[model samples]
Target: MWVFWALLAAISAALVIVLTKAGLKNIDSSLAFAIQSVMILVITWGVVFFQGNFHEWRAIEKNAWVFLIAAGVFTTLSTLFSYKALSQGPASVVVTLERSSLVIAIILSVIFLKEKLTWQVIVGGSVMIAGAVLISLSNSRD
Candidate 1:
């Protein structure tokens, strides 16, 4: 079940990158991000309401609020940078680099989140990072 959810998240994130890049070609990145953020906020809040978790929101402490805000800012910056990179580079290269965030996430999860990296994760992450490097350097001469 957890693996299914993780796979779904990966697929969904890829779709988001492709769709966002296509959308950004015509619209301003900030405008696109604003629209996306609004829709996500509405849908998430709606789900919270449906789950009867609205009341629990009141118990969220100031530190939680700060963390949430920081997360939002980080997400916003990520989107902006992605859009900018997409605008400047080939979509294939941009998408590949964007997906490299998985490597960053794994590293951060180990460092800050105190997550243990099993041998499988080490091997998988190494392969992925190698692939990214290959993709980045392979076409440089062309």
Candidate 2:
């Protein structure tokens, strides 16, 4: 089930990259991101309200709130940077570089979340970063 959800998220992200690139042709990346952020806020809150989870926010602990707020800030930064990159570069190249975050996420997960670090994960992340670098370099030559 988790794998299914992950795959769905991946697909949705792909769509977002393509659609956002197309939409940014005439718009400033920051403005485009802001427009999309508004939609995200509305849709997410709508879901929470529909599910009767809007009041659950009061139950969140201080630490959880801190982490969530920090995550939100980082998420905004990440999206803004990605949008700027996408506006200036090819989608394929920008996305490949952005996907390198997987390696950083794995490292942080192991250190902060106490997640198991397997050889396969290490090798896979290394290969992924290498591939992203290769793709980015190749794009630069063209």
Candidate 3:
């Protein structure tokens, strides 16, 4: 189930990069993302209400609220940077670079969440990092 959702997210993310790049051709990155943020906020809450989960929101714990708030802040920052990058570069390369954040997330999980990292995980992450760097350097040469 998780893999299905993750794959859908990946597909949507690709579409977002392509669509945002088109929309941002003449707009400031910040403004473009701000418009998107508004839409997301409305749609998210609308779904919650439609699904009758609005009441469940009150059941969320204090710690969960804190974490969700922090996540929202970081998500905004991350998205702003992504929009800026997308505005300045090809979406494929920009998204490839953005995917490097996975490595950082893995490292943070290991240090803060006490998640164990196997050699395979380390190798896979290193390969992803190398791929992003190589794509970047290749573009610079042209």
**What does candidate 2 score on TM?**
0.97
Whole-model lDDT values for every prediction: 0.84, 0.96, 0.94
Better of 1 and 3 by lDDT: 3
Error of 2 at 44 (Å): 0.3
Q: Give candidate 2 regions above 4 Å deviation.
A: none
Error of 3 at 131 (Å): 0.5
- Per-residue lDDT of 123 in model 1: 92
User: Model 1, poorest ten-residue lDDT window?
Assistant: 86-95
Candidate 3 structure quality by residue, lDDT tens digits, 1-142: 9999999999999899999999997899999999998999999999989998888877999999999999999999999999999999988789999999999999999999999999999999999999999999888776
User: Any idea how many clashes model 2 has?
Assistant: 0
Residue 81 displacement in candidate 3 (angstroms): 1.0
State the lDDT of candidate 1 residue by residue for 10-109, as single tens digits. 8998888788878887777777878888889899899988998888878999999999999989988988888888766766677787788888999999
Misplaced by over 4 Å in model 3 are none
TM-score of 3: 0.94
Please provide, for model 2 over 1-142, each residue's C-alpha lDDT reduced to its tens digit, 9 standing for 90 to 100.
9999999999999999999999999899999999999999999999999998888888999999999999999999999999999999999999999999999999999999999999999999999999998998999999
Which candidate number would show the highest TM-score if scored against the true structure?
2
Report the poorest 10 consecutive residues by lDDT, candidate 2: 49-58
Q: Estimate each model's TM-score.
A: 0.84, 0.97, 0.94
Best by lDDT: 2
